[model samples]
Target: MKEDYAFITEQGESTVHELSTVEALIKYQEQFHTGFPLTDKEAEMILGYMEGHDYVLGEVQGNFYQGDLAEVRERICWEEYSMDDVIDAVCEWNYELVLEAEAQRNNPEDFVDFAKSQSRYERLKAEEATLD
Candidate 1:
């Protein structure tokens, strides 16, 4: 039974966005499933919601998630939250993506080598083109 939390982020030395419960954010996020579930429009809507625009699940298209949209809206309609509450909700909502991104970050040496190789290859290609 987590309380509603504000979806606040930096905005001209302040914060914005309304308050919502973790339950609602989880429900909204659940609408966009894995395995290529969301349509481009639907995916954009979810991204918009993440970027602080208030959009309910029913307001968008896509038959991906199976649940009561009314309940989701009800939870979203809440308007009271602390910063910690908001952080918890947002963190939970984005945990999987964060993990996925972190998983792709452990190859700095390989990336550097690959980049150097690519630069040399491009330079060689340019030199060959000039010889033509």
Candidate 2:
């Protein structure tokens, strides 16, 4: 029989229904807008990372693994690359995507305009660095 799972929130709340697959988890995230908010791409990226690292679907920190929920949580706590690390990586990836989209939106035709856009992009990066 397939094991059931649930998407738990950082605040200790969980989804109303038990999810059965990676696809269901993604759908819950997209439809409910509860728990840690994630875009479709971000969710897929994080899930992929978990799977690549041998974590079962919904076995990360913010999830419930049926009867093994406590054990799963304990194991995750000791993991070298925990869910937080994956989340940070995803956030960084999304930020880069945003920056690229912004650059494309401001696409400049002439050399002078290209120089100006480059200068603006640099300035934005510096400001973002300061904020960090």
Which candidate ranks first by TM-score, i.e. highest? 2
Q: Which number leads on lDDT? A: 2
- The deviation in Å at residue 38 for candidate 2 is 1.6
Model 1 Cα shift for residue 30 (angstroms): 33
* Candidate 1 runs further than 4 Å off: 1-76, 102-132
The lDDT values for all models are 0.37, 0.49
Once model 2 is optimally superposed onto the true structure by TM-score, how far is the C-alpha of residue 114 displaced, in angstroms? 28
lDDT of 1 by residue, 77-126 (tens): 32333223333443454454444344444333588765655565554444
Q: Quote model 1's TM-score.
A: 0.23
TM-score of every candidate: 0.23, 0.31
Clashing pairs in 1: none
lDDT of 2 by residue, 1-132 (tens): 244333345566443333334576666555644456555545555555445444544433333332222455544222223335556654465467458746754887777877776776675565345323
For model 2 the TM-score comes to 0.31
Candidate 2 residue-wise lDDT at 127:
38
